[model samples]
Target chain A: MAAGGRWRQTLVGFLCLVLPLVSLWYHGRARPTPTLVERGLMRLTSPAQHAMSGVVASLSRVFTDYVWLVGVVEENRDIRRQNEVLAGLVQDREQLRKENRRLKELLRFKGERPELQTLAAQVIAKDVSPFHRVLKVALSAGADDGLERFQPVITPAGVVGHVERALGRYAEVKLAVDSDSRIATAAVGRDVKGTLVGSGDRGDFLATFETLGEAVAPGEEQRPLEAGDMLVTSGEDERYPKGLVVGHIGEGPARQSDLGWVYPVVPSVNFRTLDLVQIVTDHISTAPLDVPR
Target chain B: MSALGQSLSVILITFFLLGVESPLLQELHVSSFPPDLALVPVLWLALHVPPATGMVASLVIGLIKDGFVMGVPVGMYAEISVVTFLVARFLTSKVPIRGLSSLMITTMLLSVLASMLLALLSLLFDPAFQGHGTVLRLAGPVALVSAPFAPLVFFVLDRTDSLFARSRQRDAIFGR
Candidate 1:
């Protein structure tokens, strides 16, 4: 290379290394949070922001509830049909109850269930911009409702999202199905653990395993992640309670050559029509509902 | 009255326009189309006012845009502002006419360019940026939906300036 070109390359190399270090130094020295004055101002403004956020959240909840109300009516009909199928089984329910009670006793012997307090929150406003898929929810209750940040929000359909921003009356829910969002999840039936990521496309997700080298196929096959396979949170994230219905495996790449499963999932909640959700704020376990061993 | 006031007006106008385009008003369902009205002010300031004013206007508006933008981080707006300000400055000398046709063509090109640059910048920083499909899915429709409001914005801004100028001239004549 020419001497000038060599010098230019050297300068560029120096710049590439030096600029980031300078930026790092500058950023490291700078405070990440607002200044005292700014914080004071923010404190004053926060209530308004909270109120506006609440309004947006309530709007999302209203839409979600309206949609979910329709869904519940549909689901109630399905439940009525299933109830009839279960009706004949109800005669044998005493026998099944004994068996279920026995199984619950065994589970009770294993460990106590967490104490769970659920608050029904309504979807108020949704960031339905194709870019952002966040739903805000307002609780009929507030801090009095015992809602807190980092709580898991779910619908009867399944994991709807989680509590992001929380106020006395409302909170912002970042939905599970957001393509950019990830939640720690476990594959049901097979007990495989992985991180579930939203793929932006509806009814699809990508799960990367804690480790790889598991053979997989698409379709339900009495095993975890057998495509059509169901999965749920194992409380590994500690944000969500264990066993909340996440989604079913839509597809998993065959023969993982690495420490990960390329598993796709079908999310349970129809985010577009999601209305009412339950916030799992209290982890109540080993309650009287538990069948003692 | 002063150069600083002249520049401050441009910056304030740009800032106000940025807020106008924000989702805050979309929350109200006021205007059918929230114009990307920043361009009119930027174009006007760059052409009629000083280049320095235009540059500052771009930076203030860009910073506000970045700060308020939910999806992207800050500084991308600042970078775009600098680039757009420079580009507008360069193009001003090249383009002779400052008429409606020119403004329309300029707005179309600049809006498209800003969107493209934003996409490129976003892609460079974010891993999820490969989803150009998603950005286009959002920005393309938003730009198209919001484009028709640009001329209307310029019309109002022009009237405001003319009216203000008329008042100022009358004051001077009346020695008030």
Candidate 2:
């Protein structure tokens, strides 16, 4: 090999080693203080990332809209059938409306608590590694939009996850199904409370609930939690507010011998279809005087 | 084909793959185990191009991947790609992959190695990354899905190179 070629090869090989070591060192840092290099790279790459994502979003919208229109006729037929069924329930709908009004009035009797503050954000991208089961979803909202790390992200149905990383104009949310995610939850109107942990299986949205009690005593049995029971946030940790729906019990309360009972919970929010989500910013207390505990 | 042409083609292919991954693959609802299409070009370049060119292409593609795709540590994928490129370059030079079966096996082996390296890096660097066992379980499936694309990508890249060569020859003949 010529001297110049050999020198170049040596330099490239040295870089091949140094770069990965630098990356590993950066990764090992607890709170990676973004150096000038990272900051500059982020600034340069952020715009390109946003533009690429936007272009992809536009193309997908066009494809889905145009291609999916072909099924409109079949969809219309199904809608007509559903409309006929709905027509027969018109009277029932009226009765239900009256009952709903009464229930709304009764709920109003408890007054409003004003502590909860929320901001809506649109999901722009999702990063799922082929090797790892964890999902990190990026949103349009960021630090400038009052999105902070550890804030709970939710859909109308239930919790999605917490903010994992908040950047200048973008943030990454760690999905609830990620194995590292843990939520404090309880069975609604039941004494059962547990820490719900994600199972890390993509096919299964069911989280495992590890109960906070001793195993059933010898000769004495605990009431097994049945399927279809609602689980809600206990708010004991103050990370999430009380009374928000979490998920529904799926199969168990099966004894784990040493670890009390364990249950599978089907999350209320379907993460596959998530688009728009709200970030909980603050909690306000809304307790009214003379309300019975 | 000229070196510049090859480099441009590689960059274009990498960008196209990134664009497809963001919304198209996710829309297809394969976010859980999306196949690594970008690796096809890296492997192809390593097998066909000069070592220096292949290494440079691998590093560039890896940087693009880290910046654009799943937000991994900056140099993580770059290192993996370079390592894979070097290995593929070495193996092809020594053993000479002869048939489709051998090519497929080579791609699968390289994919598995890349997946394992990525998992190890994630475990070491990504503090929030959990499920070391999950990575082990997924390596095979990821390799399996990625392997089929190798032949198709190689064919396309080969065609592009031939077309570039023909164009250059035509320009030379016409004295343009």
Candidate 3:
């Protein structure tokens, strides 16, 4: 090729490559909507993402464990100061006590029938993804302790996620808030029931109700779901047990569709660096349609 | 100082500013975040190095990062690092990197550009990618992180430049 022609060819080649990228930029910038291609890309990149997640999880675990020493002192001082500052908190404690009692009753209700071994783990990480919110945790015991995959995980805050990947000493819990995680959840109050789907972003999940008359107010809290709401497994789907805390209702608008109520949930799992987590090893079910009472 | 020493100075200073300070600022959970550590290092390299050279450095660093902790595609960082290097190089030469305010402003602009580029690539290729907050959330953080660290990085680079006046070409190529 002539020098001029070669230069022209180079320019065209560059444009050919850059044009679609520009187009993609425009498309991505226009809206954060995912397309079929994007979904395929996510799946294709899952292994790499998973591996990176493990490295980060391990590193973060080490970082947090070491930091905990200094954190204990700061925490103690903060707690002591709060105790002195809010001494009158005891008067209001009565109402909190009653609420706590009711919550414990509910837990006992759910825990009584579970056939699997349960281990409680503390949250050590928060969601790292700016887009999809998934939580990972460190187990007090690993497979050596009989922890297995697909076990239902929970927190008093709510249904966090399940074990996505595991090793002999460590396992990764995929938070319910992950865009890929879907659960058949029901809004027990007002007889409004629907399928709760994770939206990846907190306050963005879809609670699709089939009933046409159901009403939801978007951005309004229908109820006082605390920062730590108990999420129990609803065995309706048979994938999980009868009452594992799935997630809590986060801040967002509840849409009242002619069909159902969709409430966006704020996941309770601290996804950044989960320190401790509980695994329910024996709760997987074969049936998919049984509704939980 | 030797050529290797100059290059080492640049990468070391950049790494310290980015890997350490960026996360610390994020932990502070401040409303307006500053420039990130990664962006700061990438920007510094782009300004001081040639495009081709910067591109190679970006690819190497990005691959190392993929091996390190990021939960994204393997080649994604390599691609982004090159683009960021080119953009910063273009902006620094065409605009100005002489004054602190100009440097800060340029760094801020470059950080935003890098963020937008990463965000775009992420949405396209990373299925599990959930955007942090809007650009608004990142801007404050970027400004906060990069502003204070800019002088420190510049000072180190300048000292290394004087120390290795003989091997200036290597320093230029390596962004030391």
**Against the true structure, whose TM-score is highest?**
2
For candidate 2 chain A, the 10 contiguous residues with the lowest summed lDDT are: A284-293
Local distance difference test scores for all models: 0.54, 0.67, 0.51
Q: Candidate 1 lDDT, tens digit per residue, A23-132?
A: 32332232333234322322333334436555654675455434343444564877665665565466467757865764464345224333656776665544523344
Give Cα distance to truth, residue B98, candidate 1, Å. Answer: 3.8
Encode model 2's per-residue lDDT on A164-245: one tens digit a residue: 6555555566677778778887777666777778876677766877777643444557545778878777776567777667
- TM-score of chain A for the candidates in order shown: 0.53, 0.68, 0.46
- In Å, candidate 3's interface RMSD is 8.4
* TM-score of each candidate structure, all chains considered together: 0.56, 0.76, 0.57
In the range B41-140, model 1's lDDT, one tens digit per residue, is: 5555555555554555565565555433333334555556656656766786798434566666666666666667667766665454334566555555
lDDT of 1 at A214: 45
- Give candidate 2's fnat, 2 decimals: 0.44
> Per-residue lDDT tens digits of candidate 3, residues A1-293?
67986676456435433543543444333222333433333333333344444555556545644444343566587675565446536635865786577557546734754554666554333333343444434455334545455567765445656765444334456666655566655443333334556565444333222222334454543542322232344466655666444555555655655454455555445544334455666654532322332
Model 1 docking grade? incorrect
List the candidate 3 regions with Cα displacement exceeding 4 Å: A1-153, A162-174, A178-181, A188-193, A197-231, A235-241, A247-253, A264-274, A279-282, A286-293, B1-35, B64-71, B127-147, B153-176
Each candidate's DockQ: 0.10, 0.41, 0.18
Best by DockQ: 2
